[model samples]
Target: MNIVVRDTLEAAEAAHVAVKQAAGLAAEEAALPFKQARLRAEEAMRNNLTQAKVLATRVGRLKQQALEMARESQAAQRQNSTTDAHRMQDSARELMKEAQELESQAKGFQRMAEATRGGLGIYALRAKAAATRAAQRVNPGGDGPLLLPPPPPPLRPAPRGSAK
Candidate 1:
């Protein structure tokens, strides 16, 4: 799982102002691009979810087929034939597990996309804050009291393979 920083007043206010800065689509002309963006994003997400469902369905079919094979193997075993029911049973179980994993992965990706989209405001704020910090550092004391809000803490790096 990812460890996100808890929002402090500094980060929160930056995000608030950033939202304000990104707003104001008064003109219908100004809104066209935004509307197109919204549509594109939604379409991509829909397609992704559809593909995930298709893959999950395939996995489910594989699981059912495995179960059918297991049943047939058991029937053969009952007739004193040399079919390994245990192997078929294990394969069926593994296929079932694969189906569950596929579903879980799809859900996780969906949430991640949502979070990243929602975090774009924060991303914009971060860009402004970084610029402000650089300006202040280079021209310290010379600039007439920059009234910029304090820069946010650096984002922590996610651990490798951590978001499983």
Candidate 2:
């Protein structure tokens, strides 16, 4: 009877240990999805940051080109070369367009980063803001003044009456 009781107690202790281990395994299994989701969010945030940096660099280069074009346009104008001035203005406009596109892409990445978890969103936003501030410094007035073409000359009233 003593040996049988000892065997029963040992069995119970074994069962208890198994149960505890199973419970721990169950808890880990349940947390797996959350862990995976967190990792995915972190990865996405990293990707967005990478894209934002690329766009920022592109914008910086475009801004530099625009500044150079503007200077060239000014020099042309000063030299009384209206045609060269117009061509340089067109080139500057193209540079501005490219820069604006890159800025937009960077902003999109910033928004994606903001949608993610783990403070990555904040960093993304800050990067975008810094890029914008830099662009603004290069292009004061948000895009500089519009350089619209002059309107057509008005028709003479006498010519209109004769045509009628």
- Report the lDDT of model 1 for residue 120: 48
Note each model's CA RMSD in angstroms. Answer: 21.9, 38.6
Q: Residue 124 CA error for candidate 1 (Å)?
A: 19
Residues 1-164, model 2: lDDT tens digits = 34444455556657655655554455455545555656677999889989999999999999999999999999999999999999999999999999999999999998888778555455445545554555444434343333333333442223222333
Task: Please report, as a residue range, the 10-residue window in candidate 1 with the lowest summed lDDT.
Answer: 20-29
The local distance difference test score of model 2 is 0.70
User: For model 1, what is the alpha-carbon lDDT of residue 115?
Assistant: 60
Per-residue CA lDDT of model 1 for 1-164, tens digit only, reads 12343234445557545443333212233445555565666666667667667766776787787678778778877877654766666777787788778778767666755764664465345545554555444444333322444435564434544552
In candidate 2 the C-alpha lDDT for residue 8 amounts to: 53
What lDDT does each candidate get?
0.58, 0.70
